[model samples]
Target: MNAEQAAFLLAHALPPEARKDCWQRKFTRAHRSDLKRLGVTDTQAERLARILPAIAYYGTHGPSLAAARTPLVILAADAHKAAAALRVVLEGRDEAMQESRGRLLQAIESLHPERCEVDPARASFFHSYDHREPEALRLLTALQDVEQAAQHAVGCMPKAQTRAVAHTYPVELIDAALSLDGPAFHVSASAESKFRRVAALCYVAAGHGEPLRAIRAYLRERNASPEN
Candidate 1:
């Protein structure tokens, strides 16, 4: 089998369980000839064995998985940031809240009937009671309500945010081939060349679309590159 035939075989030859496990112990030094028979060099086969799991992972999830997940990932991050900010506010004596309270108190004090002349509209209504006292009471009541709301938010916030989150999904096979970039999918230098080719073929094998002409053109460019 030539490289093209080998690529086709590699797309479907491995067992599902073995593919899922990335053919870990399944391919050993003893199976070098098996890979050689499929037109893969011993060095290339070794690299291929190492990268199979990543390829299988991409196959299982498909190319569009990352695009589908990106928006939700960003939203979750925003929520986490908002929650963290809220936690900071509720977990301590908030300086801003204290500042606001001070301002409100000063305003209420300045508006007191004793401090300043009461407005005619205010002086006429139940002239016996001071409106400042009721206003202060209402402010305190509103503060209590805010405190209760903050407590509820504290209870609702996640106890521990995951330190490591894979917000960006691994780059797909077709994408890696098209871009000639696969670091996101962990494609190592040893396996880079053949892996990109086979990965693109596998993507086509999965019935995604007729991109063979583009794939061929890309391969030609890679072959002509100084790095290749």
Candidate 2:
């Protein structure tokens, strides 16, 4: 056998079970035909048979000495690299959660309070406090307060201060945040109505749209009906 083939034969020869019983042998010897195929002389074949060996009892089925041992070291190294890659991916995902948190907060603050309707009952239900502030604060408070829920929706505690965040925010991200690049509106409604729509869209994008919309809808319906 060649040097590489010889190494494989030696590396895989000994089974642990064979170690326990010396009589138990691991055979990896090339057959006469195998040596013939390799153009091995009878003397060379005899030498190969002597060194290349295997145990008697094994998995019961396998290739003859012609079989090459697995490249386990390379495989192990690859697996280790793959594991590290996954760790990096997980860390990045956590960082993204932080970024999302920061972005959502920024979005709330950026929203002009005078423009939106922050329904008091909805805000109170979410915040568990009596905040009658306009829609911007209510929405901001909602994002701030729902830490656990945000982590669940986003996958972890969210990101940095405004200045660092501002550098990160590209024009595309801003457009996406506002959906300003989405369908343009010809608003004939009040400022509150227009702002409420924007607020709802933002909250929805933050992954907590259900509760936000529910409250908004309830308040709208309530407002539409005459007070008892």
Candidate 3:
């Protein structure tokens, strides 16, 4: 489907009653539980919460995508990568010069969710040795390794502060990774208080111009310092 249609579908999927204006506002409290059932971790759930709504909106909105299994699986794979990239940024560098390349590439692979399903038919076109399930498991194992590496860094921050940083920082890293930006851009920029990188991209990809006008104002408000 075209980007405009996808954007409309995404915007429509969002519940009207939610308070936040971030990409994740599309979901309700119940939606959070839905994510857990899908095997998203407690830490990753909040980030996936932003991506799943778009997938759901498109999954049912388009005929070609809705009738097939492949698109959803592909989306599941991408969402997993985006989620993993965000998780990696949560790995504190402590003023290090750059993010690890090996780690970032692993970010894309490691996002295989624990609960992801693999049908035998979809698993292989040739033989048992070529099965997709094993490949998926290998990726999940990689993701776990990154999480373990980040654990010590996480210990350096308070719980509440980590959660706050997570809301914006991780999302930035996900966008940077996808955009193929340079290593200098890979590090998280905590000074940017707002989170328009992903949200704006979603809208732009949707080809919807209406939201851009309002989004500009919303950004200004977010960019403003609290004391001012």
Best by TM-score: 1
Pick the winner on lDDT between candidates 1 and 2.
1
Task: State every prediction's TM-score relative to the real structure.
Answer: 0.25, 0.16, 0.18
Candidate 1 weakest ten by summed lDDT: 164-173
TM-score of 2: 0.16
Error of 2 at 158 (Å): 46
lDDT of 3 by residue, 101-131 (tens): 3344344445643334455565665755323
In Å, residue 179's CA in model 3 sits off its true spot by: 17
Put down candidate 2 lDDT per residue, 65-144, tens digits, no spaces: 22222233344445455545433432345777656544544555466534444555576544563222344344444434
In angstroms, the error of model 1 at 92 is 16
Q: Which ranges of candidate 3 are over 4 A from the true structure?
A: 1-197, 204-210, 223-225
Report the number of the highest-lDDT candidate: 1
TM-score of 1: 0.25
lDDT of 1 by residue, 60-166 (tens): 43335445445555555555565555444333467886565456556877766464434556666545644444556654455555555555554565544433222
Backbone clash count for every predicted candidate, in the order shown: 0, 13, 2
Candidate 2 vs candidate 3: the TM-score winner is 3
- What is the Cα-based lDDT of residue 73 in candidate 3? 47
Instruction: Select the stronger candidate by lDDT from 1 and 3.
Output: 1
